[model samples]
Target: MNLNQKKSAFIALGQFLSQFSLDNSARKEGVLHNDLFFDKFIDLIELSQSHNGWFTPEQVHYAINSWAEALTEENLNEWLSAYDLSNVQPKTVGLILAGNIPLVGFHDFLSVLITGHKVLVKTSSNDQKLLPFLADYLIAVASEMADNIEFVEGKLENFDAVIATGSNNTARYFEYYFKDVPSIIRKNRNSVAVLDGKESKEDLVALGEDIFRYFGLGCRNVSKLFVPKGYDFKQFFEAIYEYGDIIHYEKYANNYDYNKAVFLMSLFPLLDNEFLTLKEDSSYASPISSVFYEYYDDLETVKSKLLEDSEKIQCIVSNNLINRSISFGKSQKPKLCDYADNVDTISFLSKI
Candidate 1:
């Protein structure tokens, strides 16, 4: 599509989002947000007190919109137009979807779609419908997109390139299975925070969204923290305690209650904010039941630790890091241009 066409299409899609209000419809259909218009996708989070799944749907909506904005004809000409899609061969790409969070594999799917390659998508049973609905929406806007898309219930092996995301253990199988193909294999990665100890209560409360949203289920969710020595947890916890209703999930409630019991049994030190369960640990990610924190007196020391563990840390949330703060909602707002493992997916696709 040309720049003018792309921009025009984006306006149309954005307006459709406003008019037809798919988000409101999605909220009603969504397990999370069943009533409020603004509550649309934010309500579907499995464990947290459901507030429209914390934009599980709206985030997806904005991302696609952002992509449309960025992929205008002029932008494409600057970055992608020079690359030849016609002479370059088409690739058959296989996408293995993960339902750990909603639309987790959509980035890979978008990479395959936008790059003029064929996608063999393996949808997660837990999230069976969203992709199909999204694709249906896109196909209406771009007719050729359908020709390049395919959804498969089972797995397939023969392909030109692969992008697989799983745990550190499953990465071994991906590496061994797709040896010759150009691939990006991803393992567990979580976001973190390095507090300068000067954050305002308002920012700290917003940071709570980064930590507590989705009950810490996503890569962008801060599973761990780096704080100054003897930092008080009072303001931070109180800022975010209003989200207490996330414990409404019976299963999540059980896990939180169980972890609390275990922490008590082990004599672990914690701050029972009466809302969140915070414990001491040197970890990058947290489960639905708990959040972890560690103290560091030296800023340089914390920087080194963050860099050394960048492989494990997906995002670093802080008052000073603007880029990092932008990712605050990344757990929920993945877009079409973002490839799994942060790969240059369009570049990969142009070659295919």
Candidate 2:
């Protein structure tokens, strides 16, 4: 199918997704395939939790809403405007998805299809249900897409290029395995927030969203903090107090209790706020329910360090303290143009 046809199909999928939310799921009349697929989609969303304990309704709905906002005609047109897709020849692109969060690999899926290439997707077992369901919806909306999309269960084969997401160890395996093909092998990267000790209560509260959203499982979640020397976290803790309800989730509570006990037994210093723990750590990857923090004497030094270790960082959140650093609370809510790892997926797909 052509570019306009592909864009229309995804826009319809977005309209269908906009109907469902944690707060409300009022099925609108005009959304394509609503009569046949709407209720089934809702059932799948409800059943998602059984498939993956972390895929709670609230988290699934948030992911859905984010995509709904992203796949608008305006957003789609603007995102695709930067690329020349008309001269594309169809190629099979293999996608090995990461299921750390809901619909984590949807962007790659969209890129392959929108750029006139076929996609062979191997869904992460943790997220096996959602994307295939949406793919089915897209096919129903535009039957031409059925030939372009395939979900592989066992081995990924018969593809010209590959895009895979995994931990650093698995990324090494991907590099070795896909050595002969054009690829984007994504490794584990964490986001961090730089605190200047001057942020407003609202900014800190928003920063709490960055830290706790998706239970801090997604890469975009701020797992580390860079604070000024002798920075007091009293206000930061107080501002995030509203999210204390997160501890009510059994899985999160188990993690919090376990991680806390492990730290205490190891005699590590910690700042606990009942639900979340803050530990002085130089590491970027923090455990669930805990955030690693390090003190910085100067912004330039921190910037230099981050620049030197850019590959390990996915995003930097600040009040423009460093160039291209996103604002507080907005890390997880990435725009269509905000490519992960600063690798332009669209441009890469256009070339390959």
| Candidate with the greatest TM-score versus the true structure | 2
lDDT digits (tens) for residues 174-207 of candidate 2: 9999999999999999999998999999999999
Overall lDDT per candidate, in order of appearance = 0.63, 0.95
Q: List ranges where model 2 is wrong by over 4 Å.
A: none
RMSD of 2: 0.7
Candidate 2 total steric clashes:
0
Report how far off residue 23 is in candidate 2 (Å): 1.6
How far off is residue 63 in model 2, in Å? Answer: 0.1
Residue 283 of candidate 1: its Cα lDDT? Answer: 75
Question: Model 1 scores what on Cα lDDT?
Answer: 0.63
The C-alpha local distance difference test score for the whole of candidate 2 amounts to: 0.95
